[model samples]
Target: MFRPLVAAAAVAASFVVPPAAAAPTPATPDQSASAQQVRSAVTELAEGLSLEEKVGQLFVTYLHGQAADEVHPGNQRDFGVGTPAEVIAKYRPGGVVYFNNPSYDNIDTPQQIARLSNGLQRASRVPLAVATDQETGLVTRIGAPATQFPGNMALGAGRSTRDAERAAAITASELRAMGINQNFAPDADVNSNPANPVIGVRSYSSDPALAAEFTAAQVRGYQQRWLSRDSVSATAKHFPGHGDTDEDSHTTLPVVDRTVEQWRAVDAPPFEAAIRAGIDSVMTAHIRLPRIDPSGEPATLSKPAIDLLRNDLGYDGVVITDSLAMAGVRKMHPDAEIPVLALKAGVDQLLMPVDLGLAIDSVVAAVRSGELTEKRIDQSVLRVLRMKFLRGTLGHPLVDESRVDASVGAPQNLAAAQAITDRTITVVRNESLPLKTTLKTTSALVTGWGETTTRTLAGLLGGTALPTGGTPTEAQIAEAVRAAASADLVVVLTNALSKQPTQQALLTRLLAVGKPVVAVAVQNPYDVAHTAAPNWLATYSYGAGSMAALAKVITGELKPSGRLPVAVPGPTPYPIGHGVTW
Candidate 1:
């Protein structure tokens, strides 16, 4: 159903590394980069690339599922998109865009990603860009037992740029070790609007200056980690002002009505700072900005935004397009016409077009027919080659065992997650009504919460999926309510509402339930005011630490001391930064 489009957008896009020929590494090599020799080996593998293959390096197609997931019958894998092996042997896209679905074979370990990078390159016999949304906190793609740090908003509020820089460095180190060469992170889109559909916690801050500072620090942090080889390149994304738009681009084109003065002041600084900081890649957003291009082609197909990057900002790196299949482009042109238009509009590479081969052919045919210049194609290939060279994946596949494995998400990683959980597990307010010491209720009402799910290994916690402010549908809530009615203390594990309708409605509904409602806020401090559920606990970011912190509070491992650091508006039902202690 339409849920697929919404579900896909539900994947919160998010972020990070170090050093030199003398070599650079992070404090911990939880995920270590490949050695220079391996990088050299990969570079050597690039020596025999053909003309078509060289051209193929300019497009990054989004395959259907994960690398480990086997492609099934009836699922088309054309357009430079498919399993890592098939996509390599066939479409040979220059870069690959990952959709975080391990069930389809894509996974949560650096080793798994490294194996995918190796397998894909081995089949294609050419180096490629391995990228994903690895931003920690809210928009993280890689999760589970791994260290999922606080989101940009939290980092924006943390121990200064130095702390953020270290976080970014750690992130890049993790990605590089996993064979992920490029990170589509450091969301420069400032969280200027609270109701903005997509880029909320994903943005570094509501303030432009802070967002710019954190974005730059994070990118620089990741860049500092992997010198040149076995490093990860940073991509600052959603050019212009995707942060303030209320429309969700995945399903609809959200237009930013800000005047030129508004944009020049509010939306332009973060990106300007990122470019100035020497970010390697800049991605176009799908938002329609009439102030810039009134023709309604969206930034991805408009020359103005791309020109801003080149002529105005003096950015000479690659210009990456957001996925072309988004309704943003479909609203203006034929699906096949997306890649062609983007090329003509000054974009370097078409990202994740619906049909890989068709998209490639469209670009190729445009070049051959002189509609798109061959020189343009070469320029993009050169950029792709440069990145491949930098990462040392150019020569051949290097599947080093030490650089990967499930242990990447083992103990410490989960412990880090738990630590973050404790720090962010804020108690906005406490009535001293429900005591944390004693088992207050006979039947505990546990609701499904968190960015993903709340499934415990032991199955001891039987909670209904209370997908608050996140992605729970009506059907999901109906089930949650039924489960809550049978419990004594209802724990509503609610996700933050960043413009997801169904989830928000479910949370609003959960408040009236006649039980001791413990609302678990996952993403933001704002959710405290959004929920009417009297008793609430905030796990600022959901990860191992958050989960552990919540468990500790429930089991008296630690007492609730965190109060709401931010204020909430009244008449909003649930007041801002609101929290309750047992």
Candidate 2:
């Protein structure tokens, strides 16, 4: 499934210069000092911690109100709880995972987000390494005229390594301004199928070499922490390779049939590249790779898989598991057993452990019973401490409360989102006029399929909602068919923020209409690629910025300059990697 960006050598990518970020008033640890002073702060913080506290530093937690007394957000009540400080202080959580939702969402402009994040940092006992899954070109938390960026396969399309590198650097810079330090991105999963239910647009390519190169460049660009170099760290994900599976791991456990030898040569390349380039973290996917461990459990709970990451790939960084509650491991593996297996399997820290007290009890019990060794626990703790040590978060003094407003989304952050959106718009199939100069008729049908894509396209494209039942029912399809027969064009949208199943249905409906349908895959090229209609433009992500880019590309405001990152197999019954330029 991995496809290499085979373009001739040339630097390629887009840049969005943003307003200078105001430095957070040097409150607690005085970040405005020389390297020596910062190092001194780090050292002072590091020297006093016991091994238990040190090991505790590696764990990352959600800012949700897991506790009973936590104050709930008035809007989006169930989304999460606690401010950044509460999460850090209560659990002594090493870091915080920034998840998007109706509450505390990342959909805000980057400037707003940057200031919000600054407030979060000030609340932290230590400078918690802020994290999010902002893989450019697909699955971004940011949006807007600053929005559009191509996914990995699009970068692979131009065979341009420089494009991948620049996008990575840009993504890092934007996030840094907003105060996010970790990006669990540039999915190294080598997507072999255009129909791969989950990993398609997110993966770099099915070609291991290409995945490796793209991932390497992306990490370097995202990691330049000092000066102009973006200080944000990169976390290459789903370590033992998840792209080959056709099944969706979010709902079901997707198993890969490849043998260890096969994976070593194919699936392991990008991780190898990431490690070589000095990445900070490696997040595991909820995938089952049997050959690696031979144990019945998925790769996440398998010792061989985690050990291979260390001994085989030589990754000395922290190894974190995907959400514990995700279906892949939750239903099959009882909650009590998950943490133990992960720890024994060599996973350093558990993420979103819903049953925290139980998890801690289980691990502690394992140690008391000699089921798990103290030495192993110490090693894991050491890894956690080392990482925080590197981040300069170990022993910084308390952050001030006065500067809380300084951190919301930052301008540079929003600019980066807009820049990527502008560059990642790939015009896959353009028939009549490459870029339609005029709408001809404003009465187009707008169907919102994915979450992020809908809001963006509706506002930018100026299309009438596909009536009340836009869910694409049988009646809706019939109506759409009749409308397409008479209307100027039919415009369908899938979330440019995250790809989902609804996008699949939307494409099927448009294809059934059998009319001149211009589809925008706000998610990934894979969203629209699976159904090869006459006109398909893939934005690779659904950010307001990216959606704006899509509208621009459709109307010739921004040229359709990007290429597909991964191959969108034509009609599939044919083969993967199928693409014919218009």
Candidate 3:
């Protein structure tokens, strides 16, 4: 059983920024003085911290538990502590990142998450920045009870900055209600390569200018103060671009061989836009660009690569590294030296190191041994503290858990999510669309990448549902085809058909069934290039909002208005803005 607790009583009223001027704009003279005062206050606080505590302020770590007091053996082995509260007390990290991995189980419900957040804060002396990867498409960590907006690519297809802003604002509000102050979101990557495994739909568009526009809009949205509380900090991620790589950085290091000129044209615009919008943090990519840094190191550990962000982009905000536990940052260096190299490379915050204890000790030792100067340590610490102060984390680190349910996944937020995704249904081929007109007495079969997705869409349409796994077994494919034989319309959902041969086989067999077939690309729109389904549509996501919007479009209750954010390349190529309107 879970209990919702009142907000902690330690919140400082002086740190709250007036709601009217919460968005980061060019400071007025008075605002500048206020900012200076914040810097001075943060400096004074930093001066009082012990060396170990100051070093601890540079890391954002994670542990496996839902409740603060829950004991886990992994936590005991890793931190010599049995609970999250104990880890926070010992290390006093600057922040903690939440994940929804069932194995880790750090998040469960709105009430539970708020309670956990308050508990963690109570354990730390200074306030902690509770963060999560609530990127809100295929990458969303929190489900259902939170509004699920169609992701960046969907916004790209709709080409609406207002939608992007509204989506991000709603997401930020829910995050604050859950006691989270930072969101690693609004991925600024321009998805130039359709084959990019990690960033396909996460990116807003392939066009640099469009990606930049949406990135700036979302940054403004996330940082806009809501309900008189400080806005959540938004991070524009995978800086220096993770858009062209076909590999997943989590598994291994990816090399992007673009020349500096090409990188500027294709990758740098969105991050530049993010900086201009006053983004609170910029996350480094685990990608190697030999042309940018001849030393052959991934950007997360390369001074030259980071200098591009610091010097070239003129961004002075916090620079956070993508997870240190990733193989991309770990394959070339020993665990103990990874954080040291990252700090040396000019990163301000180390996120999710493989071993938290080792990372903290290494940085502390480096500072004491003159490998890293205390001034350098103070440089990062001041930035972290300043961010905490400006973002209202220092003022209101706790949320009234009892009121969390009222804000998170609110009815208005869900409606906005549905409205946004409603405009994102892109019709590529419509030979058999507007099912209402095509079939007077209709029987339909819904089969796709996710079992829940197929069943949910089927239930909406009152159709027979045959759910297929990611790599559909021959038996699943045969069952789908057999189920489709008696249906008036066959709706098959495809996710990256270019990679899933089994799904491609299933789609091909369904197409041959001779009934009107509607193929929907639920994950990546590029899946359309691999199939010859005469009727095709793309929802860009399989979230409940997207599925609801998709069903309305199929039933002629809504029109298809979304354009393709990226080109579909194959024997027959679709241009970047291709979409058919009925």
Candidate 4:
């Protein structure tokens, strides 16, 4: 059952004053209690916890289920528990991470998620830091009924810090309404490598300065108190930068070969800006930087690497590992040993460990054997507790589930998303633009990589929708060609054209149909470099808002104001900040 309002207030009041004459100021939405007060409260709380409970406070794990009380086979196998409530009762983890993936079905509807959050919190002795990767673009874990933005690169292309801040603010409000107090967002990695498989389009820009500015703005937006007493803790991720790697950390450890100086110049600026902006947390990257830490450990396990954030950047907040279950961190140590090493290396919270039971037991064993001191455990616990206090999680862990629906995808939030996406649509080439003018007496055929995106675009333009797969088959190309022949215009949507040769072939065939072809790169603007289509536009996302923005640009309802955040190097090379305006 949800904690009543009066009970919550009483619980909040218990932590208000220390057992001293001079009472410390209570934490507000924007500021935490005085350091002394928080430390005193944390110390008193720490003194009462058992070794296992203290170690438990250092972890934030993900369980498999939508509701906290629902039985899940995966959770049963992983935790010897069938429900999130049982897992929390048994493990007492410091926090919980939410995912919308098939394996971890933690998010469904807004009210369902709110109820789930409340259930999880009720099962916990301490307030659980409920978090999700709501980074707004490609990494958004929660989808529709929640306003979707065109992503970080779209915001980068729009080149407005105000838009970046507003986007984050909207996301924070929605996330808090659903009872999620933490968000891993505003990806600070500068997409310096066009070939970077993981961080492309997720990054703000290739320019360090621009990435820094936007990162700070997003941090401010996310941490700012949206309601009088509620705000989401914003985390700047992949610290030291994952922007230069070609490999995904989920599969293997990638190497960032920048020198200490080069890393400081290219990769460190955004993190610096994030720290300066008072970001609540910094997530370590799994990538190894040989120059900074020659010990051959990923930053998540590298003392020198983490020191850059601690000593150099002076970030004294929570430090979380990306995911111990990922191959990048797993390759170095055994499943049980990874958490111990991450803690020894200075990460406060172990996120998504491979085996929560084994990880906690290992830490407990390490403490017992004197390998890791209890003081070390308390330090991390205090940091986590301090953050929870500052973010108002301790006081108001349970949200009013009834109010969730009214805020999740509010109309004003949707409009903010559309307005941001509209500003991010970039027209790279304009040979047959303002399709409203050119196709006044003719019809258009929308054929593209994504079936839904193509159909949506077709509906918006009142054109025929010929949806094609990401890799269009020969028969699909033929069908698109036949469809193009009957239409006066062809709006070809391409996603990563360089990777999908079959889709590129479809674009070639549609262009040859002798109807004017307008190519819209829905996912990556770099798709423009691979094609010679006389007309090109880039929306950086295939989201609904992006589709609307694309249709409006084609119809001349909105002018393209977005610039290329990353360089496109091919026949017609486009530098950073290149965009065509009418």
Candidate 5:
């Protein structure tokens, strides 16, 4: 699909500025001194560790509170009480990833999760790098008062670097407060393909430059370390690029066939800028790039791709692989062989290997048999230790378990999220806002996918609610149109009209009515391209904060200031940056 862009990308690459000449960050005096000291500490720690400890430092395994009723393989260890201590004693992994399963309500509160992290630290000789995928919006692992900020697309729509920084800073504060030291976020992918199932709202924008700016802001924000707390390492993930592919890597390996120049034009800038901004980690993607590496290896186990990150981008920080459990990589190799392949490919840490004990043994065997040298293992171990020292995990590794309740979702954090949401509700089309003045009444009909969401929007507008299930039947659309006939105005809420045929039908039905119809996109902004509604709004999120912010925008309490982060596909009346003000 992207093959034709090679020539244009080649021309663009010549004009793109090298990262060496990029704008320098305004680092404080204390930060500069601490940076050198942290590096020295990491080197010293690596030299003192034994061979067994060095082997352990290369693996970052997972520990989820498995559901009591659910039965699965490797369920022997519950990760409760004595079991985790024994596992850690034998395997001695470098880090542990926390996962919240939807099927089970395990570690439901912040305090419980914090206590779990503290227990894992106690069982390890070196401090564990506790991590989570707290990307906000649908991907946020931790729930509740922990401000569910709008996703990356909303931040791109707002187009405020400061807002991007604020969102990351607040997220980092909460994670560190709960004893989690790493955040796998601020996705750098340039979402060029609208059909991308996995990287849709996760990416900041389709424009490489815009994504680069926000990615850099997020990296700076996450590494800032407020309130004198330990910093949470910010990761710029799915390296090289995951945006051009339509396939999701979770179920199958997506192939991106763009030339190296195409990648540099659309994907490399963000990673280069992130490296310059001092990103603490880079995560490899599972997708295969045929043009970049002819051997047909996924980026996780390809030395050329990893070398591009190390040499071309000049990123010296820790390089971590995306979870090995994903079918993209799992289908390619056995559990025991994955750790060795990742290390030989220049990855510093192996994340969520299928079998932790088997992975450790494979790396140990590789070193002894000359397949992998002991010195090569030491290099990666040094980088992992440096990350822990830089994040303060080695020094002040423990959190005050009592403070977890007060600090996890502080009221101020929610306020910041709301403020960002308020600034990011994009008005793509409008006949003038505060529909009360245009229609001469507050009475309106609000219909959407869920009853709760429809009711929330209706209540905010002081109107009646009509729930239109995602796939609305003809009878349901008829009922909604009848309801719209009596109202002063009609507002239809949609997530993605391209994906939802019923929602598109409902929009067409509402527009058939003589009354003015306004369409509000709660999730994907692409719906606006399908409707000719006089008023259109895009929030890029269905999160609570974004919904409340949308309500304020509809009632004229807050102005819609956000621009479109990406092109609204199909036939849109507006350009990429189009938005209404006042």
Candidate 6:
């Protein structure tokens, strides 16, 4: 069972650097203009910074408060030594990552987030590139009042780069309106393994080519100034790929035991395509590939892996580390040491360092002790400054707080999200779908893990809303069976039934009822394979827009056109890209 959808719970110009050769061959007109501008800004900014300030430019830490564990429904005005604003003022960090999670109580609304970002920029001498993970569907950190679209898998199901582009464009437009310039999104990893826990629906597809197309489209959308004058740079994440592992890096280091040839054929293409499309940054995965680096260090701390990204794939733009606080990286080194090692490993930005002050100080100390050179520090700082310059953050640091309401969650954007989501409803097994019956007289029984689906079904089909408890018991299943006896059709909505034993048993009971049943998977598409229902649907997400699309398909208002983005391996073979139309 998963959370409900639509219901409950849950730059510049300036100086020039010395040429390597006198009168070197010139770069192309259009492409070299922006590259030259970045180089000029980086050289200028780097010249004006102290050693401590230069070191700070390489680290991006979490913006959390003293009372981080407590929930403050209102604005938290405590900008002290360790606080977010205080960290910016003291360390002069190049960037700061924002989180509105339950553990931290800083952000409650878009206006509050805008205020926080604005305040941090005001405190800093160099405008920090305020960043956040705005990966629309399951990973949306920005709460309600912002338009939440279906994620990459949903977009992949739609099988349209145009939809992927439009969704990302809309996302970037809203993020820029809120003053955030960088989005850690458009996951380029191929979901090659069905058992992969972390990146199931986060990835676009199992097929490398399909994922590559969507990733490139998303990168273009995020960078497109034509979509919105206010554009947010997209980061293609978990590089060298985080889609084939069974382990989660948050808890333990994941290992991808594939040879170079295998990785090239499967996981490397999407990242290559994203780089070609000019993505702003590529975040390193904490996962290890023994075939690539026999030293056994995660990609975030592996120089070989970094070289592979830089020289092999030819991705020159900022190489960011996946949060150093994770167990994958932290288990290998202490908080103070992560900064120095990450920089030495060729990471341009040390993201979410475990200890903010210690990380900055250690990098400075590392330079002094010959552990890292000043030139190495300058290399990363230059990239960071280049990103800020390219994003126009140096020119305009603060956001207009008043525009939070009018700009984000605009009606047109939400409509586009719903339309895109509607296109991702893959009907894997539809037996005379669209009900093929008159709705008003039909006695329909709707049941699911949460109240949202039941409520939605009742509103749509005049059905009995039978909401199941999380991991239902025998009694609940019996009650559902009794209800299904008199129903013309039974609609079962599931989140992840494969993992939920009680939900699986409930499905077994529903099948025994001998009624016309339709099973809809609201989260993982694999649930369709576990149930005996002849009609199976995959919304690919539980977002409001995703559910709205599902509702339209159920009522025959819209045709089900989405295909399976990832392969669902079971007794029934539902290959990636398999779909059924109305």
Alpha carbon lDDT of each predicted model:
0.63, 0.61, 0.86, 0.85, 0.78, 0.79
| Per-residue alpha-carbon lDDT of candidate 5 for residues 122-234, written as tens digits (9 for 90 to 100) | 77777788888888875888888676888899999999999999889888888888888988987989989888888988889989999999999998788773213535888
TM-score of each model, paired residue for residue: 0.76, 0.75, 0.95, 0.94, 0.89, 0.91
Instruction: Kindly report which residue stretches of model 6 are placed more than 4 angstroms away from their true locations once superposed.
Output: 1-34, 65-83, 225-229
For candidate 4, give the lDDT: 0.85
What residue runs in model 1 are displaced by over 4 Å at the alpha carbon?
Answer: 1-51, 64-86, 102-105, 108-111, 157-163, 225-230, 395-397, 410-412, 433-491, 496-518, 531-537, 551-582
Q: Per the 3 Å backbone cut-off, how many clashing residue pairs does candidate 3 have?
A: 0
* Alpha-carbon runs more than 4 Å astray in model 2: 1-47, 65-70, 73-87, 102-127, 136-138, 141-159, 177-179, 225-230, 331-334, 395-419, 435-471, 492-516, 524-533, 570-582
Give the TM-score ranking, best first.
Answer: 3, 4, 6, 5, 1, 2
RMSD of each: 9.0, 9.8, 3.7, 3.9, 9.0, 7.6
Error of 2 at 328 (Å): 2.4
Q: How far in Å is the alpha carbon of 220 misplaced in model 3?
A: 1.0
The positional error of residue 75 in candidate 5, measured at the CA in angstroms, is 4.2
Ranking 1 against 3 by lDDT, winner: 3
- Report the C-alpha displacement of residue 347, candidate 1, in angstroms: 1.7
Pairs that collide, model 5: none
lDDT of 1 by residue, 1-582 (tens): 223212211221110122332322111122334333323332333344554665677788665544533564313524233344666667777887666764233664566666666666566545568788888887788775455677776565442677677667667766766777788888889766667768766876666777788888877876653234435778888887698787799999888877767877887888888766667678899988887788887989888867776767666667888878788767888777888788777777778777777777777778778887766766566555545544444432354657466445556555544454454456654443344444533456555555344643002333433433357777878877777777665666656553455656666666566656666666665666654556656665665545666656755556654544334333453433344544
What shift in Å separates residue 437 of candidate 6 from its native position after superposition? Answer: 2.9
Residue 316 displacement in candidate 6 (angstroms): 1.3
Please tell me which model should have the higher lDDT, number 4 or number 6.
Answer: 4
TM-score of 4: 0.94
lDDT of 3 by residue, 186-256 (tens): 89999998889899999999999999999999998898752235368889999899999989999999999
lDDT measured at residue 39 in model 3 versus the true structure, 0 to 100: 61
Tell me which residue pairs clash in candidate 4. Answer: none
Indicate the worst ten consecutive residues by lDDT in candidate 4. 21-30
Q: Tell me the lDDT of model 6 at 36.
A: 63
Ranking by lDDT: 3, 4, 6, 5, 1, 2
